[model samples]
Target chain A: MTPEDMDLLAALGRTRAGLKVEADKHYVVESRLAPLARREGYPSIEALVAALRAKREERLIWAVVEALTVNDTAFFRDRATFAFLRETALPELSRRRKDGSVRIWSAACSTGQEIYSLAIAADEARNLEPGVRFEFFASDLSERCLEKAQSGLYTQFEVQRGLPIRLLIKHFENHDETWAISPRIRQAVRWRRINLMSDLSGMGAFDLVMLRNVLPGLDLSVRARLIENLAARLTEDGLLVLGEAESLAGVTEALHPVAGRPGVFARDPAYRAAAA
Target chain B: MKTCLVVDDSRVIRKVARRALEDIGFDIAEAADGMEALAWCRAAMPDAVLLDWNMPVMNGLEFLQRLRQEPGGDAPVVVFCTVENKVENIRLALDHGADEYIMKPFDGEIIAAKFAEAGLL
Candidate 1:
């Protein structure tokens, strides 16, 4: 593909999914989009881009964005994040609420492992405090991911990635070569297909919003907008969880990291005051 | 390097388990059946055991009961690798000192994951 084609693809990534496709990542664009182009009956990626530029097709544009977006995730991806959730977040949220209800949103929960992991943790938490009610909401940019997450079925290789054996045996039913998560765990989360770059005010506030490992690959402006969108959904005392390597520094002042906690964030006191 | 004793009646299963274990950095030792596995353990205890349920001369559960009685036998992480997918069978193995269980048709990834969960990896 030519420089203009690469630029168009990069622009689509940024505008649609907040992904930053640098010029150096031209090969990534080629390799990932190659199969998509072929599947969509285009002779080449250039042809696909030609069609994209000729007429702005929403379906084709989303297909390109989803193809480029990396959905590499596993159960309990960052141990410390879940440790904080179980040890600190759950107890504090349970105590702070008089109604004994807590709502959590797994923003950008790719393929459902993160949400299921959250469900498993929450289920375990309920044993300790029977009165506490946990509501799970998960959204991803890709319809493909949302469908797979909804199915709650995983291959042997998929299940092996970060899932504990005991939990696997407990929550998943083995069906020959595949494992399907129990209905109890599967039905716990409400799944939605949402592009975080768009307005998020329609989605109600969540006590914990998890947008892990998503921002690092996004363009600077997109990162700012996406973080603002996620933070807007957080209740006043709510926490935001990002990937371990991700930080709010220079991204947005809407949320600030909880002191000493690596990826945990809370609505900025200044941001909250301004909103108030 | 950690040592694992792969005890299965089928040589093919033993070979597969051996390659899988070795790939994940385990020094592998193989036995054709429970009796052979017991004899090997008596000489030198392995760090872990990939055990099969059914075999000639002795069975997995029987070997497990006997192994746990021997000195230093408790050191090995005995993981049952078998065609037995029944929950009752798994409970029986765990009740008889098996550390973890993997159903049949397992691959390197499954073994690695089970080993990781067992704290053997």
Candidate 2:
């Protein structure tokens, strides 16, 4: 891409959605926005870049951002993390909290798989606890992802990934072509649109926050703000779960990785915030 | 213990079905095709037969019909396990008197559920 094209795509990505595509990812940008350019009657990529630079079309700009957003997820995407939640976290939380209710938030639930996975775990845990209650809050910046998550329908191929056959029969209704999650599981989660770079007020506190597999791509400033906001919302005893590849050490001093728990972190009582 | 015959052209499927049935406390038997299964049934009756759709010499639907004709064969429960997952295929299998059906590539959990549904567990 020419200097103009690079500046245009980069600026559009940053301004519209706070996305930071590396300079070398022009190929990635070209592939994602190619169809959008064609739809807008641009003769080629060159023509589309020129159009974007000259006058921004609101819809066209959003399409580019949406296309670039990562929604690569599947049911029980990381079995180990879920196993930790099932085997260790839920039981410990149940013991600590006097109240029977537990609140959880999936900070970036792509299509609700992670939330539903948690539901399945919690439902199974009822065998031990008898009647513990669970409330879920799921959020994503993508409206399309939220809609799919709310509907709880998945194709055979989708169900085949990570979702076992036994769970499929128990938790979903099978149509000829697709499977719909049982109404109880589908209705259990509350969905909303939340851009991670945005503020965190008014959402209320959570006992367990699952912000898995989504931190690497963010700019440093956005990451710091989000961590501080998250740290403040998390209760003193609550756990903040990050992706397997993420670390809290350099990211923020307020949160520290809990001992022996691979991805689990908790508020650091001794942390002194950097002087502004 | 109740006896169950696992009928399939593939040895792997027969082994899998045998293991599943055995897990549920059924004495397991194996037959390679519908013809072999019929011959076995004439000799001795099983409590249930986990059957496959396409096999050499005789198919599963034919075996179910032929089994129904035999005096003691009709007593054994029949369940179809096949790649034909369409509703019409399932309806046809059930109409032909197979007690239940499970899709191919199933595990012991699926077998247990389908067996429970068929009242054979």
Candidate 3:
């Protein structure tokens, strides 16, 4: 790929999707966009990159990014992460809540798995304390994934990823070849398109925000900024969950690990005191 | 939007598959044999692949296995669109990572439904 193409692809990935496409991965980018170039009537990758640089076709630019956006997720992808939510995080948040309701946000909740996992956990949690309620907000950068998630449908491979057979039978109904999640579970959650790189203040405060399995791929500055931004929206007594491998250790001081839970975090008291 | 790469030794087969997929609004590409298909996939990963068996060069099973070894190999949804309908052949293709299988002499309707079943359409 030419230097110009690299720059254009890199810029588009960064600005539009929070994806940082390295020069080495140009093959991945080119292959993804080659079909786009053909469909859009650009003769070659060069022509496509040139057109993208010269003018911004909203649809074309988005097509490239969308193609590059890999909707890689499965239900309860990390057992420990969801286990934390079911056992410790949700219960602690429930006890502290003034209202019977608790709001949980699943940022970049790709294909609805992570958010739905939370909903299942919330459902299980509610059974123990009949009065407590759960409200969910799930958002992703890819509109395609959001659509799939909103449908609450999954293929066999998707359901087999980590969903226990019991929950699968109880919460989902088979439709042709796919499993459509039960309406009650679907109704408990809200879906939206939100690129984390942009403003997030519009989404109001939440008691638990599951931004798991997403940080390690990002640039250091981006990781820090995103963590800080998410922390800002947490209610004073809220929790922020990261992938097991992720951390706020060096990223930002706005959030810190809650003493006992491994991947769960809370706004640092010093930061909170200072903010107030 | 979804993308698909149709691979077959027969030009007519490739043509038909491409047309059928294009009508469904897929951005489609084609390769005549497994060797060319491997090159295409290594460069950029398609959302799905419609593959064929019994090619002169690397066969579909060979290509699928080799492709699985490449970086980002797990990304594509593969459907073995071939004449090999033997139980062993189907099992082998599925074991080799073919997401679905369709017999030859298929139409747009079959293509649409199979792809839909594979969660690609």
lDDT of 3 by residue, A130-177 (tens): 566778999988787899999998875566566754466668876544
True C-alpha contacts between chains kept, each model in order: 0.25, 0.04, 0.00
Clashing pairs in 2: none
> Which candidate leads in DockQ?
1
Interface RMSD of each: 2.9, 6.8, 11.2
**Pairwise DockQ winner, candidates 2 and 3:** 2
Work out the TM-score per prediction: 0.85, 0.67, 0.64
Q: Per-prediction count of colliding residue pairs?
A: 0, 0, 1
Best by TM-score: 1
Q: What is the DockQ of each candidate?
A: 0.31, 0.07, 0.02
| lDDT minimum window of 10 residues, candidate 3 chain A | A267-276
Q: What tens-digit string does per-residue lDDT give for candidate 2 at A66-174?
A: 6666677777666667777887778766665645767899988988888998888887664335455688889987777899999999875566556644566678877
> Candidate 3 - CAPRI tier?
incorrect
Expressed as tens digits, the lDDT of each residue in B1-121 for candidate 1 is 9999999999899999999999999999999888999999999999999999999999999999999999998989999999886656767888899988887888987898788778886
lDDT of 2 by residue, B70-100 (tens): 9987799898988776656767887788887
What overall lDDT goes with each candidate model? 0.85, 0.78, 0.79
Residue-wise lDDT of candidate 3 within B65-84, one digit each (tens)? 99899999888999888876
TM-score of the second chain of model 1 compared to its true counterpart? 0.98
Recovery fraction of native interface contacts for candidate 3: 0.00
List, residue by residue over A1-276, the lDDT tens digit for candidate 1. 898888888888987777889877788889989989999999998899999998798999999999888788999887667877877677777776646789999989889999999999877664235567889999998898999999999986787667765677888887775889999999989999998888899999898998888887788878877778787888888888888877888778888777667888888554333222
